[model samples]
Target: MKRFVLLVLLVALGGGGYYAYRQQHSAGQEARASAVAQPRAVPVEVANVELMTVAEEVEALGTLAADEMVVIAPEIAGRVIELGFKEGESVKKGQELVKLDTAILSAELKQAQADLGLARDTHERLRSLVSRGSGTQVSLDEAIAKLASSEARVELAKAKLAQSTIVAPFNGVVGLRSVGVGDFVAVGKPLITLTNIDPIKIDFRVPEIFLSRLKVGQPVSMRVDAVPDRTFTGQTYAIDPVVDINGRAIRLRAAIPNADLTLKPGLFARLAITVDQRLNAIVIPEMAVVPDGMGKMVYVVDGGKAKRIPVELGKRLPGKVEVLSGLTPKMQIITAGQMRLRDGSAIAIKDKPLRTSQL
Candidate 1:
């Protein structure tokens, strides 16, 4: 009887332990199910889409040029006697630049003047004789012709003498000289280069499709690799009337004030012309945009969940972009932590929402 009681007690203890173990296991599984049903929110940064001023711009690559440029050459062959200005110096309009030997020309002018004086005396004598009826009409007419020829000769000599001195046609800077004193130069030989660059020009071409939007006096902004830190502003002053048949582009020219002479001709330039502008246009931070297949997308937080939105983009600005569609003002756009986000995924605000003013 003692042994039976011991065995029964042992079996009852084993059954109670097993029942407790099963109860604990069931409770643990229930806890795991509840945890799976609720997901942790993803932390993300957000910004508000707001209306702001946006510009419609056209961009093109161009080359810088001088407003006025010319190659200075002699009009007549002569030996250079004097150089009035130094190389690479500013010259005023009508300033004397070069002087040639005028000895031969001066002698010819003197001879022509003497001949003119003699001709005038002879003509007067013939006219007086004619008035007295002593000279024939044909003789008086020949004297008059001689007087006219003398006058023409004198004028020709003066013109030739004037050509010995070369003057600047306009206010500009002179380049290096190719001839020195006592060096003989033929007519039309390039002697120097003169350029007017205070108001520089930029030449660029745009596709024909933009012709309707282009106009004279449109504002243009330019940048160059030589002057990387500065941005130059100017206005469109000219457009080619004819389009380039091969490229289908129209050429444009802009004038930029270069009083400091920092910008030089022949430098490569990047240009942006503001063709149009719109106030109260939808704008957003560039970071909020995500590239989708053949399109662009962004995440906007609504009801504490991330909603993927497809957007059409317009002109791009500095660190910002214009949203033409699929977004509105005052919407919270996720700018950060988008890599782990999916449509309708729960999100937690990581920081204060950015406003348009903040951007």
Candidate 2:
């Protein structure tokens, strides 16, 4: 009975092994059949990588600033007695903008002058008396010192009286008046804003890596959202010698011509400067780039297959991007249908690819 049971187990194991082998053979045959089927080609538009001249630029957000800007303030506290200039009016250098009441100051100055005159007379009398042996030398010396002190007081009073009037520091336009006639203002209080806006200055910053390419008199172009249709051109007139420690960027200043007086102070501007130009730069259409995680890539149609290649990008131009590496001139890259492409995928060009000469 034991021998019969062993034989039955052996037969069952052999049958199970044969069934497993048959199933494995069938799965292998299906895989081969699937491999024989062709994948559908992705229809795409292609652009050729062209070697051309590209302006290597540094792009940065900039601010439009007056060539010289300041808030006109009074040096001494007083009530506004006169407004020498009107709001929004062009002011010349040394033109008076506001006049504070000088009644008390004038009175003080007159009193000082009177005291100085009295002291001088007294000193003269004392000196004459001393010469005539009537006043002591000490008395005469005291009178002379009093006269000198009085003169100094008069000069101080004159200086204080001059502070009552505020004048334009430069040729600029005056902002709105902050104080009116009879309005009391304190020292250092903002009375109005003075901005010299004819030739405006644009303040911007660029990464420190571009330091070597920056210099005075480099041509740059500026665009502002307020005047979208116009483009203002200027030259970089100054560069900060030191780089900002926190941002690793260097500051720059450009002189923008505002002869027509269209650009105003405090307008937000976009600045682009061509630091260098590459005659052999590999340029591709901006649509050809595929953002992959933190980097960018492109699909090059190589030998009728989609080949994914990572690219290092440089300056961006209108409708195009500079390719620093991972591509060469005359290479065909899928631009339109790259969204449906993968590495080694089949690609069919919807039309003839763009020629390098035409790009």
Candidate 3:
């Protein structure tokens, strides 16, 4: 049919007279035919599917906490007499942190001691008189009762005097002082904050599905914005026995040693808990995979054509990803120039096919 058209045109134009026109027309038609017969091949690169060993990890939002935290408060109201510890100072357990005025307590203690001394003398005299038949039994019994009461008062007075001093309940770092000398503080008013941060606690939660894998000493690694570029590690110390009904999560606590005193309480934490690891797992370069709207997809060059394969992805590593399904070892994948390519589109590889290791 093409030959007939060319011959008819030659006859009308006269071969020699239209030689230049014939050449141009013939070239244009040839180009059009070539385009129709063969579409442009999209250039791409491919890699060999590989096997990788990777840890199956779960991530959770968490918080750092002081191992022990308490607000030091006074049990009885009094005028603050003296400060025993400096702000942000490390204090030993039972160290005095604050002291309240003791004038009233001191006077009461001395009076009680004097009364107790008198009671002892009277009781001794009464016993001697009774044994010698110089004292009535009723009189001796009354004196004995008075001595017991006086002794009880002395003990009570000592307890009140001790309350005038506030001692550290545990070894910790004392926070800011809330009251100063001469400040009248009420009972139960906070005097300062004390925290035991050595071997700090971390609290986080994970889905209930991981309950079976959780243990008392499972390892945990974490990062925090406050301590940038550093990873803190610890072992799981506690797990809530009951799962949260609303969220279906189990609360977990880990203890990380703060030997350097670097970690601070209440810092936000990102934790990665390694539940398990998989060996001999198929993996590929993360860039080879593309989004498929419904799930994920990757293109493989098979018989010089792009085959769009829907893939299921697994755990990921830096610059590489795990292909859980829909691919095989040594399958040529189109790593580049995939935007213009579709199913069965011809592909021209730009680089030599390399192994996933090269990724």
Candidate maximizing TM-score? 1
Q: For model 3, what is the C-alpha lDDT against the true structure? A: 0.88
Clashing pairs for predicted structure model 3, backbone only: none
Candidate 3, superposed: residue stretches over 4 Å from native: 1-55, 277-316, 319-359
Candidates sorted on lDDT, descending: 1, 2, 3
Local accuracy by lDDT, each model: 0.92, 0.90, 0.88
The deviation in Å at residue 60 for candidate 1 is: 1.6
Q: Which stretches of candidate 1 lie over 4 Å from their true place?
A: 1-51, 286-312, 325-359
List the candidate 2 regions with Cα displacement exceeding 4 Å: 1-56, 129-134, 277-359
What is the clash tally of candidate 3? 0
RMSD of each: 7.3, 17.0, 10.4
TM-score for each of the candidates: 0.72, 0.61, 0.64
Q: Candidate 2 — which pairs collide?
A: none
Candidates 1 and 2 compared by TM-score, better number: 1
* Models sorted by TM-score, best on top: 1, 3, 2
